[model samples]
Target: MYDVVIIGGGPAGQSAALFTSKGQLKTLLLDNEKGLTQRALIRNHYGADDVPGGELVAVGRKQAEKFGTEFNKANVTNVIKKDEGFTIETEEGDTYEGKQIILATGANSKLAETIGLNTKPSSEPYVKHVVDVDAAGRTNIEGIWAAGTAAGVSVHTIITSGDGAKVAVNLLSDLKGERYVDHDAL
Candidate 1:
């Protein structure tokens, strides 16, 4: 089974995969390549002064792939909990097993409902039907997490990216059976 299966390709999912894969966890990121980030065109997204959203996605995915994170461009149709972990089924009729799942499907997406997680409407202005998550981006189900806009955070790429990193770190800590501090060098 893979260490983590991230269910989104947006900023949140990509950022999470970057961290998880860098942490040496076998990671798989599934996405159909159509998130709110596709429309992003700005200079306020941290490092870069100006860049298209698609460019960011491409660079982030490339970086994660360089770190050994697998990418699947398919629509995830269903997720089922198993004795070992979880099974993610895609519209392409493929299944992947993972020790953990992270939902980064963006705001108002109800992918969690298919997995029996209790989701609620977002209280944010004009935001609706966001997945319910705890402080650590945890869903009602164990081994499953919701991050970025999927967790009811703002739709901004910067905030969602940070949220994704935060959720990834928390999930990594849980998987290691102790607190995991990400250290780049010896």
Candidate 2:
């Protein structure tokens, strides 16, 4: 069992992994290389200057690894709340448990093409994923929170990363029973 498990490996997921692991929480990051940032050309992000999204993700992953974040190259099939924590099920039948789960799967890109229009379900099955968290990136599940695209904010890489940092601080505070750190502190 880990202290926390983050789903996805995009900017939000990476940011969460960094903070949690740095705070000494056993952390794991799961992604299947199909996150939203995978296709981003990303030339306008701050600190990135002109780097591509894929490169940024690579660097972030390396940094997280250096910080002791565990990486699981698997696709999560389902997440269920267990008695003590949460259980994550992967397509390969592997299971992981964590005291807290951050749903950072990022926004489902397929919805963009369907928005502002009405259509029937496709003859072929389609998956529609939504991140409906609020401004502060609070998830629908208790003891679980989210940020970045996973929280449904329209954000570039810079903004999303910032949100992830904020969520981490808040999460830490919740665990420590201390004052929540303001986003500016991050």
Candidate 3:
């Protein structure tokens, strides 16, 4: 059981994993390597200007790995809040339990489920873009935080990456028994 199970491997997930691991929290990053930001043609992503979106993903994943963050290439299909923590279900019928669950699943494209016309296992949903978090990156869920596009961040690759870093720091503070505060400097 990890201290925190981040359910996405995007910028937000990676950021959270990096910080939590550095704080010595057992962290796991579950993603399928198709985060929305990975499809961007980034040009103004903070220190990385005019770089491909893939490169940014590579660098971020590598950094997180270096920090001892465990990466699992899996898709979390369902989550259940439990007495001690939470349980996550994967596409392969595997279950993972954690003390804390972060829903960094990212924005899934909205597809109106109508009279069944073959919407199952064919269309990959698009992310809605995370941008609802406050300056400190707290989400609407209690004890549940968010960052990056999962919290409704902008499409600017660099901007979202910065947003990830911002939320990451805030989460770190939260782990350290500090009052939940948003550190925008991330």
Candidate 4:
């Protein structure tokens, strides 16, 4: 079983994976390749003046991969809660087991709803729904968390990315039984 399974390959999911894997957790990122970021032509994100959304996402994926996060291109169909962890089913006939789950599926809440996660109307413009989460990204269901647009954050790439990182830190702290921080100094 993976230490963490992230559903979504957008900024939030990728950011979370980068942290989890770098933190030494076995991580898996499952993406369906259909995020709004893929079509964005981002210019407002911090540190970059102009960049294609797809390109940004591609780079993020590479960054996470560098930390040993496994990436799978598949549409997740179901997330079944198990006694120890979760069983993720995909449309491509693949199943992944993980001790924790992070929902970063952008504005799409279909999977969240199907899995019985509590949701509320989204505050972000154009997003109708989002998974209900605590300040630390914990869902009503234990072992399940959410970040980015799916967690009712702004659709902006920078904000979602930060939210993803925040959730990752919280999850890592839970796993480590103490506060977790990651820093690389030159």
- Candidate achieving the largest lDDT: 4
lDDT for predicted candidate 2 compared with the true structure: 0.72
**Clash tally, candidates in order:** 0, 0, 12, 0
Q: Model 4: what TM-score?
A: 0.98
Cα lDDT tens digits, model 1, 73-168, are 988988999998999999899999999999998864657777788888886676677888999999988899999988999888999999999999
lDDT of each: 0.89, 0.72, 0.64, 0.96
Candidate 2 has what TM-score?
A: 0.82
**What lDDT tens digits, residue by residue, belong to model 2 across residues 28-120?**
988888876877889877776777789999999998899799998987777777788888788878999989877676665332222211222
Candidate 4 stretches with Cα past 4 Å from truth are: none
Give candidates' CA RMSD values in order. 1.5, 6.3, 6.5, 0.6
- Candidate 4: global Cα-lDDT? 0.96
For candidate 1, the per-residue lDDT at 12 reads 94
Q: Give the better candidate number (2 or 4) by lDDT.
A: 4
lDDT tens readout by residue for model 4, 1-186: 999999999999999999999999999999999999999999999988799999999999999999999998999999999999999999999999999999999999999999999999998888999999999999999999999999999999999999999999999999999999898999
Model 2: residues with Cα > 4 Å off, grouped in runs: 109-129, 180-186
What lDDT does model 3 reach?
0.64
Top-down TM-score ranking: 4, 1, 2, 3
Better of 1 and 3 by TM-score: 1
lDDT of 4 at 132: 96
